[model samples]
Target: DIDRKHIHIVSVRVDETGKKISDSFEKKRSDAIRKELEKKYSLLPAEKQRQPENLPLKRVDYKAGDVKKQVSNVAKVVMKSYRFQSLNEYRAVLSIYGVTVEEVKGEVRGKAYNGLVYSALDRKGEKVGNPFKASLIGKTAGYDALQKRIAFSKQSMKEKAVYNRSRNIISTLLANKPDRKVFEKELAKNGISVLFRENDDKRIYGVTFIDHQEKTVFNGSRLGKEFSANVFHELFNRNGRQDSSGIDYEKQFHINNQDYQPEQESTAEAIAGIFSMEQHGDDYEELAFTNRMKRRKKKRKGFGL
Candidate 1:
């Protein structure tokens, strides 16, 4: 035998799918492996002839627990990096990350189609799954759970935008630390109302903001603790006199006109102004030079006379 390796005869039978293989399949498989081993040997140096690739067994199996942990780690990374507003969005993003999802269609436990399964590719392009069930991952990872998260995310996004806008207005109006009455007026002008919680001693304990433009109610702590009642009192003080909780209006009016509000000017407008100034300066210099030339000509005429 050219290859001095011991070979054992194993059972030869039809596969589970009723497919039959002859002795040629095993011979071909052996030849392919022999060529691979020879190529690996040719590439190795003489000093390291006993490499692990030359061992009888080369492939190793990955444990099921390790595979599950890898999948869950990928899921956690995706969840942190992206906020998927819908299940389709989640699937699309997951596909980009080498994970594929399939919907389990049919009734389960007397319900309609309400399950999902996922698979991932390993390093060798082999599919591996400790297949992740939707319900098993967590409550926020299921089909209906994603729908609820989408709704909440949309609302939260809207609230954040309104909060930023309101904060900008507050900063602009209170740049000089105006009194409580003026501060309230400025907020009302921007279609925002502030509610203060009072204790039994008529002292303010907390604050909440009601934005008419966004139709959302947010407590001071939700925006941040810095926006709470104590901070408001500090902002509204004037000349050692402070009154934080003084506004009393049954019905709040909407800021119908945008003229009362101020927004940041666009960069294009500022750039145009700069160019305009430079153009005016150049025109003035040219006019001054022309006037000097005229005066020089008149002086030459007088000297010649």
Candidate 2:
């Protein structure tokens, strides 16, 4: 406290080392860690920069204008074949069958008396011909005999009605087509058998006829390539041949190996099973055994066979 006014201090000095100890240690530690990482991972070294490979270029030559012109030409040709007339006036031909007539004899020489004639009616059941003339004829062959003959004739006519009607329909449909023979051939190819021809003077344009349980008619020309293609496709399909429908004839299943089997699988598997049985007898026997077991199980479960 007494020497406060004249207090003195001494400073201490240290010599500089080659590098700071802490800094040297940090540098060495960093290098050691880098070397350890390199030894453990062994990553690929950096490579020289390179240019990317060039890909081949392509060019389209189709011009929009040229495509439009070509499409227009095809459209014009197709349009020319289409009919534009009103369809309301289209007529079909139908045949009247089982038609029988009766005439009465006159008391005077060389003159036949006109009397009521009875004929079998159409599906509508309307009595055909004059009743009085029918009665006179009925008198000649008794009512029972006449009725029997009429019934037989009616049955025969009905049997032929489908065929007759189909012919009439086809003829009427082809009336304006101008390619009747071609159309007929096409229909025949499709299994349509023409029965009778219709009168041309009636100006009928379309006809309908019976094809077994089906009614088919030709009404107009095929609309386009697609329609023609479809017709041919159906024809070939039904005839067991390969048409342009992309169906492979060789791949289908069949009961007999000689028959056409399209490459498509059948839902019932009947054809495939039959074919397999024919080709692989042992496999077929095993399959049959399995099927029989399944049927027995189903029967036990109260399912209908």
Candidate 3:
């Protein structure tokens, strides 16, 4: 999270003459100045180190059979809730994130296996969603490696999509200077910022536009598999409970024989089901309320109107 008010903006301008300065005698002068500044900064005292706060961590141990059973249970619950016409739709969404499903088998002929009937593997051949198989991946070096690979793959895909869209917009804008200015102005009006521009060589490079006051609303780190499951559970299982005062609160749906409270149940299940799931506990609602109050206070404090 960033403090939007503390953001600083720096602007750099480059023109034909400025470019010539870099190519000529100014290069040596700039390099010497940079070295001098670096030497001066190196003599400064080190900053005080802050003590690291310890976080609670837990390890889950389950076998392949246990994972199979959990997946089957979760699948059954999802199917019952969702109005999917076919199993294909369910499988398709899972496959989008490179999840592979396989059926478990019995060693004895004609006898059914009590263990996991299906297992899921990620793109890196490591178990992703299946808790039973996750232990294997974690024990090996595959878990961390696969996670990084998947994250990078997804980010690359998103960047490519954004780049393609930007290219089309840029091409359209280049048709006319007045239209280009209009496009930039429209983007500014909407607070849709950019961060790069072209140089005299026609090569697009360097930061162009940045929204100093805009705090990033969502972080990819918070949208991992566990978070997805929590969101899914909240959206699907939980019903909005209306209080006497007419305020609605999200309540988790519970089945028979569960000891966890609504929010705890959903969060625990989500954590147990997904890989790298962090325990956010029941603080989401409280945090939201606190943030709302803070925003209200800031609004009152900063804006007299």
Q: Which is the leading candidate under lDDT?
A: 1
**Candidate numbers, best TM-score first, in rank order:** 1, 3, 2
lDDT score for residue 170 of model 1:
63
How do the predictions measure up, each by TM-score? 0.30, 0.16, 0.21
lDDT tens digits, residue span 81-182, model 2 = 211121110011111111223334466576654442333322232333323233333243333433444454335445434245445545555454423334
Off by over 4 Å in 2: 1-178, 194-202, 212-305
Q: Pick the candidate with the highest TM-score.
A: 1
Tens-digit per-residue lDDT, 1-305, candidate 3:
11123345453556656652234666577667756876788743222322222111111112333444334333333222222221222322222122333323466687764222234443223555534443332322133333343354346435334233334443344344322224333333332233222223322212122221221111211223322223322322233321112211133223222311113423322211212111122324335545765899999989884
User: How high a TM-score does candidate 3 get?
Assistant: 0.21
Q: What is the RMSD, in Å, between candidate 2 and the native fold over all Cα?
A: 41.9
Q: Kindly list the per-residue Cα lDDT of model 1 for residues 158-251, writing each as its tens digit.
A: 5466568766776687576777666665676676655444433433444555444543445555566667666765665434444533434333
Q: CA lDDT of each candidate?
A: 0.48, 0.30, 0.31
Off by over 4 Å in 3: 1-66, 69-133, 137-143, 160-293
For candidate 2, the 10 contiguous residues with the lowest summed lDDT are 272-281
> What lDDT, from 0 to 1, does candidate 3 have?
0.31
Ranking by lDDT: 1, 3, 2
- Residue 77, candidate 3: how far off, in angstroms? 20
